[model samples]
Target: MNENNGITLSIQKKKINDDDDDDDLTGCFKRLKKRKNRKVKKKEEEEDEEEESRRDIDNLV
Candidate 1:
């Protein structure tokens, strides 16, 4: 790469790293990874809710 590309990359990296909330960068990364996890689809979530509601009804009965 050219010298300009190196300089620009360094400047962008510094800007991104300078945020005080950089402390939460790891948490942000974890949340992003969880968002990408394929096991959590809407239908599964709905089914879990239905199961929970059924359990509640059984307990009440």
Candidate 2:
């Protein structure tokens, strides 16, 4: 699995040896990724708002 960013999943064949581990792992990974994206977006927005607030305060001074 390449961890260079984005969802780079490698799915093997679902033989008898392949249980629900792959499927479950993939699903969990997707969920975690979605949550991470949301968190990153929120954090960026908060930072931007903070910058804007600082600018406003500076203008008032």
TM-score between candidate 1 and the true structure: 0.36
Q: Model 2, range 1-61, lDDT digits (tens) per residue? A: 3564324233333342367777888999999999999999999999999999999999999
Residue 56, model 1: Cα distance from true site in angstroms:
0.1
Q: Which stretches of candidate 2 lie over 4 Å from their true place?
A: 1-19
* Candidate 2 steric clashes: 0
User: How many angstroms is residue 15 displaced in model 2 relative to the true structure, after the best TM-score fit?
Assistant: 3.8
Q: How many backbone clashes does every candidate have?
A: 0, 0
lDDT by residue for model 1 (3-60), tens: 9999999998888777646768877988888887745676688899999999999999
Question: What are the models' TM-scores?
Answer: 0.36, 0.65
Question: Any idea what lDDT model 1 has?
Answer: 0.84
The worst-scoring run of ten residues by lDDT in candidate 1 lies at 34-43
